[model samples]
Target: MSEAFGSVLWLIVAIGILVTFHEFGHFWVARRCGVKVLRFSVGFGKPLWSRKDRHGTEFAIAAIPLGGYVKMLDEAEYEVPAAQLGQAFNRKPIWQRIAIVAAGPIANLILCVALLWVMFLIGKPDYSATLGPTQGLAAQAGLRDGDRLERIDGRSTETAMDALQVLMLAAIDHRDVAIQASDANGHEVQRKLALSRLPADFDQQNLEKAIGLVWHFQVAPATVGTVTPDSASAGLLQSGDQITAIDGQAVRYWNDIAPLVKQWGERGGEAMVEVDRQGERLALLMQPRQQLNPDTKQQAWVLGITPAPRKAPEHDALRRYGPLEAIPAAFRQTGRMASDSLAMMRRMLTGEASAKSISGAITIAQVANATAQQGPATFIFFLALLSLSLAILNLLPIPVLDGGHLLYYLIELVKGSPLSERSMVAGQYIGLALLAGLMGLAFYNDILRLVT
Candidate 1:
């Protein structure tokens, strides 16, 4: 299947499942609250398939895959018959109404937590910082080499990998990251370091292209693992030879060699590579090959040498947690993920992150396809995360969204009456406009990424 088609299929499935579950939450809650639900849909527009349930609620699958909604028998729109008055949505107690409105987001959060727990139980491979050289590049502002990072920008980190994630998120748009480091002696120091500014072509919505900085601890040794046939590195570098330097500059590790090679390509020049074969030093002149990464649409250089995997400390094979422990761990992990996502959103809003990050249906489809290819576990995890995001977004106080409706209901509760019809109509129009504008921007970004 074509990548685009695969992406769309997965996206449709992912969105369909999440939306159906979300609408189900509202439907279930409303029934419990004695409200008459008119329709429970899995998507928008004209219904392709539908059935009236035993309770007289029309359950449907619509033509559009965008989203779904629940229609309730609201008294504001029509007079409620005496017998059916008790089943009208507006007739329900405020608390009951609130519960119905809140169910959808809660359902999403529940999915996130459950998926995370399963992921933890299955266990994901984690790289340790201990595999790196005991000494390397410092933060340059105040952090010293050999100092282990404890936190980044005030976010507590359990592993070195988490710290790197925090740093990358803060680095978007050249933001300064506050890092806390500790030495063997247990002394801790905090310092703020500014990230290198993004290139002009960088897009914030496309995360893979926005932050390209390599983590300090992730550098591999400058030893070739495999050499492709008829490639640049095949005839020049041997598998066992240690790369000592590039272009006369000393290369202590795999990380050191990569930047030099990339720079050579960017500068459109040749580089001299020095290697240590046994005890004799050998030099080779190389010209980096520049090519566009079709996936990212960005220029990258290749020398055709794949680095050996970093040796990890032998740990007991993946450990599974008990049910009780898994629950809390899942909640904590999901909360952290949500917070990190929110931080990225804030950066995008402030223009600290590139606008390219505002992806449309195309990008989402691509992500879905890629995730699907990673196997069931990975795809389930992706669905959980996306469901959580969708739930959270729907709760936002913007009109035309679930959150917006909740916001209006809250106002009604506070004022002891619904907003004037004219006011509600105006808010609806405004919400529609905002939604349209955002979709336009996302589509435009998608097009730019496709063309450029």
Candidate 2:
């Protein structure tokens, strides 16, 4: 299947699963608390399929797979019958009503924890801090190939990639990054180095010259892993031929050669490729097919050759844990993620983080698809994180959410009575407007990302 179609399919699955679980939480909790749940729905809009249970709750699968909801028997809108008043959400004690409203988000949180625990048991790919030298300007700056960076500006490096990112960000600002390192000599050293930045007309050659660091991991040479029967790559290159160079440039590594091949498509001419087959260097002249990088808005070449898989380092491979250990670790990881997300949200609100980083449905869909591709364990972990986010967001005491309901309950507790119906309705409308505005902004950002 096409990647785009696959992405859409995965997105549907993700939303469907998450929404179902979320609504189910409310249904289960309300039923347990003696509150009558009128409906438990997966998705919104018109119901595609629905069935009424003995308890009078309609369980449904709706037409829209974007979101779902749970409806409770409450007098918030209509008057409750005296016979069923005991089971009305609004007639319940403040605490019980609060529990019924809060259960949905709490269910999401619980799902996240369970998924995370399972993910930890299944394992995940990891990497250590390692750096390789890039050709051109960076190599000239006393940075040697195969040099593992230890630190930058006196900050200890957790990974070599982190150190390089600092340098790249500094380069973007035309500033020098102070690097502290342990070279081949095993002696610690430090240097303030300036990075080369690409001009406005940044191409492959200049891009390579500007930032000069490479990944330490080894990737197989550009060889056909899978070929579309009549694709450009299949027509010109064979599966077993090891790609040696693109154009006339010597391809030192897989990363070095791939972009060059992609550039061939933009040039719209014959690309001179050097391939090694059992020690024989064969030159193949091939034309690149034009393609667009949807996310980047850049034109590029297409060969349709999947590169060979790279081996993950032992330390980077997934590690399984005992059931006893997994529980605590899962809780710790979940807490940390929750805390970090809250911090980031606060930072975004305060303008400490760039608003451009605020992502919407597009970003969420992309992440969900990517995580699902990694396997069930990884997908589950992502779902968990998203669940936690949902739980936290709903608990913000904003009207139109569970937290808003809780806030009303709290006011009832303090004032010895519920807020006036008109006041409650006004708050709900205000909250809905605020949420709509936020959604609009997020969607706008998503479109900007797609177009740009």
Candidate 3:
């Protein structure tokens, strides 16, 4: 219950911050354009908290936390006094109105860049594109374990994250992706991955599994670090004990031990463990326990022994940058994300990608909560990504959105007059219907995810 509440709280905070900045853009632009601001609100419905400024603008926190708006004095909405007619939004020039309408999404994009800039300044964990295992397309392409990814197609990939981003788009389009990688001996080689074999119901989350590219990180030794209380290995295992074999099979890396123990546990069998304690060899019988995997939340075998920490190689670092470099990098990051989002959207529209990839409030809340728990830097990164997503989503040419309004304004600019009220009202109805269907699809995807 507490966890659920915490997720809700995080979601509310994230929405509130994003909405505030978004609405502020419209409010600020309108005021600068000589329009009379009526109410500046974060969220919709009844005002939860409100204050009227000396300028007669009402600032409000409303009941619904999903979205917000900056209401300005407009002749179309209400009767304007002759004296204040010049200050009405409807009286503003077409350019001024366009600027006001575009400001909200622009602010979100700016916020995304700002957040990324801060993130780079503070530094975040980084890793190379080291391969652990290759199967499917990757294996067919002759990608080997320990190979370091250099580039995808012509784009240089500095890290695994970069490669993954490229691969995701390539998979969606069923494009043949070219890659340059460094072998174990540091020899650069090129390979082409054909993604045509990927199933139509491709799961984005399991891209690595589908493409057969496992992320390789620093591997721990077989030495135990700490034992969990009342766990399967608590009594039988001790800190600093070096596990040699599992069920008479010799194990080298820590990853080698897990599957063996898990297989034994699933069949309710014991692990015939052999460990070297100090200089003495000892035979110990350990039984694995059924525990919920923290990530998958599925029943899995666990010995409850934390692996000893391994020092990260110098190559693996938190990529840090100064203000000057960070700003440019942030812009590039924002652009890259925006481009990727548009590509994914296009793929979905063309039926090359599943609509299930669309995430709703439930998924957003869960991600926000999970990222918040990871650390402040991670949470901030998540927020930046979300800000970009919000900006792009709002810019879609749909009715009842800023983009829709901008579209109408563009038409008015070209036609030398505003759209007729009857046409505008009909457009609004159509937009509402499209939006409702989209929302329903998103909700259905979210619920299906939970069930499956």
Candidate 4:
């Protein structure tokens, strides 16, 4: 399938699962509380498909397929018969009302944990968090070459992604943190990362650039591992030869070789290639064969030599556990993610982090497609993360959300009565405005990311 189609398809599936579970929580709890539920709908607007259960509760799959809701029999929304007044949602005890309202987010949290368990049972592949070349704050804090990252602020980081995530948050909050790593000799070293020095305009999206932490593989040596037969370098440049310079220009890394060779081929002349063959320096003059590059669809130079592959670093980890062990692991993982997410929210509120950090449906769909392509484990992790985020957002004390209702109920409990209709309506409008602003910001960030 095309990328756009794949993204849309996955987005629909993900929302379907999360929304269904959330609605189910409310449906199940309301029934248990002896309150009558009118409809259970996944998505909104016109119903595409619907079925009525024995209790006359209409369950529906609607046209929109974005969100779902459970409609409870409430005296506030509709008139109730005298005989069925006990079944009205508003007539229920304050605690039962609170339980029913709180169930949706709780269900999402449960789903998040369950997804994480499945993800852990199937390991995710990721690059090791090996510390590469360091500059600025990283170098000043004593981070050195060939060091494999072990932990940040006592939180263990097993992948490059893990280390980068912790560093990004720390940089956002300008929190100086202690880190642990193993040197090239397999000896442990600890240092304080001076993230407090990060400039106010630091970009969370490009933390590596601001922090000066690069992967070792990104700076591979310019050593030739293979030379194609009858190619320009076939007879002259043997395997294991390090291309130090080309046409009197320095070839600092493997990436430098290609462009330099292209320049010489375009100039249509023999170029002097310097090599360090097992530490013995030698120079050879050879002309590059010019050919149309199929991938780029342009005429380009060809030396027909591939760079030597770099070995995997020491801290490589597979995030898998046995089925029995995965239970606790899943809970631990969820707690860590939730903590990190809340910290990010706090920083954003305090203006320590940019609001552009938020993402809307567009970004979610794109990321969903990418993670699905990566593998099942990664996709599962993404789903769990999305579910947890949804749960937390719904719990916020704003009107027109699960959290907002809970807040109103709490006030009702304290005052021994519901708020005035005028006050409740006013709260709803305020809640809607806040939600609109947040969604606008999220969409703006997603579009900005697409444009730039």
Highest TM-score: which candidate? 4
Q: Give the TM-scores of the predictions, in the order they appear.
A: 0.72, 0.68, 0.82, 0.84
Determine which window of 10 residues in candidate 1 has minimal summed lDDT: 128-137
On a 0 to 100 scale, what is the lDDT of residue 329 in model 2? 76
Report per-prediction Cα RMSD to one decimal: 7.1, 8.5, 5.8, 5.9
Off by over 4 Å in 2: 134-316
Residue-level lDDT of model 2, residues 182-257, one tens digit each, is 5656666555565534343233222334565564554344554566556566776666677878888877556675
lDDT of 3 by residue, 134-244 (tens): 678899999987898999988878888889889998887778888999998999999999887888777876888888887677455688989999998878889999999
Q: Give the Cα lDDT of each candidate.
A: 0.75, 0.72, 0.87, 0.90
Model 3, 352: alpha-carbon shift in Å? 0.9
Compared with the true structure, model 2 gives a TM-score of 0.68
Clashes of each: 7, 3, 0, 0
Ranking by TM-score: 4, 3, 1, 2
> Which TM-score value belongs to model 1?
0.72
Candidate 4, residues 151-255: lDDT per residue as tens digits? 999989988877877988889878899999999899999999899999989877788888887777557888899998998988899999999999999876786
Rate residue 103 of model 1 by lDDT.
92
Candidate 2 structure lDDT: 0.72
Clashing pairs in 4: none
